[model samples]
Target: MANIDSTAAIHSHQSWIGIVQIITAATCWGTLGIFSTYLNQMGFSGWQVTILRIVTAAVIVLAMLPTLWPQLMKLSARQWFGLAMQSIVGVLGMSVCYFFAVSYVGAGPAVALLYTAPVFSLLFSKFLLSESITRKSIALAFMAVFGVGLTMLGEQAEVNWGILLGLASGMCYSLYGVLGKRAMHDAHPAPLVFFTSVVISACGLLLLPETYQTYTQLLTLPLSTWGYVLGLSLLGTVVPFGLYMKALEKLPASRASVFTIFEPLTAIALAMILLHQALSWIQYLGVTLILLAALLNAVVNGTTTRVPRWLKRRQTV
Candidate 1:
């Protein structure tokens, strides 16, 4: 029947559309460095920026609660627990670490450092998802780590919180992927992310003392500050997240991962153009190595899904 066909079509996968959606999502994610760095320059501390971003995301999601309720209701106990852990370790942890990473190290290196996520994911997947590790996974992980080391090796006048925090963010991001995938059984990502953002905002508030005086300074903030926050939430976070989910619904995760290399590339380009952050030649080579390893790892992971014992990494902004 035409009616049945229409309903099926609504749920059908369109590969090309998914590809476009993913590319767009990754590009949007690339803006994270620019927004976060600008906010930091406006005198917000790393944790304050983290709190503000999640608070914005939470408020936006709250406005959509009616639509998300159905999905929220569908979450099981196990899923709920998974989401809670994800909120703490993934959302909250990554946000604070990444904001500080960008603030301290500049955008390009911070973005490059975030590439370490896949390496951490490969390790986490084994324990959390019960995934098997392969020799290829080990090799690719080592390559990624070597690249990661290169990203951090540069002139430092003092202790570099950026590198440590960036690596921590990557670990948290890895945790997010494994936990989110497990929590996501039949549940929409919108609702899962909504819940996670809410938890992040709550945790952020509990640390308000870190920014209580900072808020006094923010009462007179320029209107553009609000715009930056809005852009950070809508462009860098929400839109990309929604787009990536849509893409995943229609495309293979491997191809999606490949396209997402655009995220780091975009970040580096934007940083160089707008923020005037430039990496050394060695660091550029490091970024290239990490990206190539990730791409190959994605292919190997996808092709050997049911055969070889390898791990996979799924990233988000």
Candidate 2:
């Protein structure tokens, strides 16, 4: 009917908007390395940087809490627990691993390794969400794994802990997406983001006992360093995350994961231009393969609408 057609049209439009929002978010996230590097140069440890960045973002998001309080108050204890776990494990855990990975291996490779998140996401979607995994998904997974191998091979003779940390970060990041997809069904994006930020900040505090010393050091930091932290918090963390959560409300986590390819691409480009870091040709090829696999996976998964009968029954339990 006409109403059905109108609803379809609206959904199509929203889908496009979601795509734009996620891509924009990925682009902003790509700059994380640059800001992180700057913070490192200012003598901030990875943990210190993570805490500062997250705390700043928490403050920014908390400013909106007054308006969001009504919706937040409506969440049940179970929903609150779900969001807390998502924030602690997904956001806080991922950030710690990722920032340390960046510290060890530099931004470009760290981001490249983090792109493996899509592969993890695919698997999580299969097992956790009970989404169907086609033969093509399996094929693309192999391709992406091969690409990861190529990237590691291109790293030369050095033993880098960053690779492991990056992979862990990717896995954690995928878990975040998967859990967040579930949480989104019960809450609005703004309140969800605010509470997650609060959890991250709280966890950061618990992890670092010398928080007062770090705050004291902050007083002596140059204005430029302060600006970088603010930029990292607002642009890199809050804005991108808010946009990404909004996007997730409109797109499946699997399809939304593909758009994150913009993250590494932007990071690689920025690394080369700003930091003057260059990857070997082989590594470039590897990055290309990874991206292609992500696109292919998105194409394969996006075409389906039917859930398996077993998954349907599982949902009821």
Candidate 3:
């Protein structure tokens, strides 16, 4: 009984640590738009910013390749293919779409659109993974969709291309998550993320004709601009990713995902305070509804026989 008590205490401590890690990650992710916007002010296009971020992150990850070498070699050919697909479709595709969404609409709306990934993830899980969808899931789905509509309509008087791109970004982001889970099943998170970064950088290389000019342009930019790039690479990509993986070690994926609601909230608050962006009251309502739906989805999906009774009781409350 004493040993059991000790084990329970350890587990509880780990759970709290996981919560802190995920919240930290979400907070960092929220700052992504601000960093990307600064890069744009340095005369980099969304695509250029995306490429630079990937390349910088890849270089940093490559420095640790020797340490990850043993685990990297353990990947089967099938897993390699899965990771490659995830990198192309998930990382590259999502980054391009999301950054462009930010450039077009602004940070707050773009991040809000990206938050729709949970809705897309639910649909993908139901269809591709054959996961059972409960009535609660269905309700949440509609609520999220309605929230998206309100957010888009509240943006401007006329509809623009950014809205579609934001939705596309959400879809690609969801695809990445679903496929990444399968690809990283037996792999270490560090090496998997490293390889994905490499793939994204490789794809960036293929766009050299357009991005080459940016290299010279980069040399002309101020030191502060370079600092933003480094921040985006380290703070936006590596540090947050590491924290997220650490959180996943102790938290269920669903609960960890719930913590991501902080991303949009942080983005919205920062955009208003720092960027002087304001949203319509309807848009604010829409953000609230979407966040509520995401929270409900996370709680409902997290329910399992293995869940702690305390967590289950909280869900009931």
Candidate 4:
């Protein structure tokens, strides 16, 4: 019984650490669009900005190879393959899509779309992971979706293909989240990140158009642009990813995702500040609903009366 108590304590400590890491990750992701928009204003095409973000993140992560080299050398062939795929789809695939989504669809709507991940997470967990969901989770989902709708209020020009892009981002991110959970379950975050960085960097290279014409344009982008890109790559991509993985390793998929509310809130705040965007009373009401949704999921489910078995199962699987 003493040993059992000790193990439980250790797990609890790890879970709390994971929560801290996830919060850090969410804060970093929240800043992504704000920084990227700055770079966009400096004449970097969306693709160019995306490439810079990925390449920079890749370089930074790869720089750790000297220390990670021994571990890489000893990795099994299957692990190497997994890392390679993770790099391609997990890092680059998702980043490119999300960046483009932000650039084309605008930050608010893009984030709204990305919020669909929890919905998908709930679904996938139910079917794949055999996790249960609760009524509170359903309420939370409705709240989040309602918040997204409110965020999208008053767009003069609707996003052309914005829905598709947002959905794609959400789906890809869900895949990244689930696969990442699986990967981190048995591997260190470093190698997983390294491979993801490399994959994304390579994807950036492939998508880069020949129009860049000269290395000077590529390397000599304006200082502000560089700063924005650097911030996006380092804080937005590298840092959040690392922290997210740290969080994932310690928490269940559904539980870890509750923290994502910070992403849209960050985007909304930045949009208001940078773009001087304003929300109507109705929109504000929507925001209230969203918050209510989060509270329903995080607090109500845990402490209140027991949730329905079906809903509980829905949350887990």
Candidate 2: C-alpha lDDT: 0.79
The Cα error of candidate 2 at residue 173, in Å, is: 0.6
For each candidate, what TM-score against the reference? 0.86, 0.85, 0.89, 0.72
* Candidate 1 collision pairs: none
Give the Å error, residue 148, model 3.
0.7
Clashes of each: 0, 0, 0, 18
Q: lDDT tens string, model 1, 1-317?
A: 99999877765637778989999999999998899999998988888888777766776766676766787778678766677778888888888899899998888877777778888987788876778888998999999888887776655312378888888988988888777766653344755565665655555565667545655666689988888888877888888888998888888777788888889889989999998887778778877888888778888887876421322333321
lDDT of 3 by residue, 1-317 (tens): 99999999999999999999999999988888888888887788888888777777777777676777787778778777777777877787888898888888888888888878878987886665555667778888899899888887784613577888888899998888777655544444755655664655556565677656666688897888888888877888888888998888998887898888888888888889988878889988877887888888888878731433433465698
Q: Residue by residue across 1-317, what tens digits does model 2's lDDT show? A: 99999999999999999999999999999999889888888899878887877777777877776777787778788887878877877777788788888888778877877777778987887787777767777888888888877777775413478878888888888888778766755544755555664655566575676666776798897778888888888899878877987998999876887798798889989988988878878878777887788777666767765574554675788
Compared with the true structure, model 1 gives a TM-score of: 0.86
Q: How well is each residue in 1-317 modelled by candidate 4, as lDDT tens digits?
A: 99999999999999999888877788788887777677767666666666777666766777666776676677687776666665666566666677777777667656666666666666765664455777767767877776657655644324356556666777677666555554554465645455554654565475556324322575676566667767887888777877886787898656776776777788878877896656666655655665556545655534543343444665697
C-alpha positional error of residue 34 in candidate 2 after TM-score superposition, expressed in Å: 1.0
- In model 1, which regions exceed 4 Å deviation? 1-13, 74-78, 156-159, 185-190, 193-216, 307-317
| Residue pairs with backbone atoms closer than 3 Å in model 2 (clashes) | none
Q: Please, what is the whole-model Cα lDDT of each candidate in the order they appear?
A: 0.78, 0.79, 0.79, 0.66
Model 2: how large is the Cα RMSD against the reference? 3.4
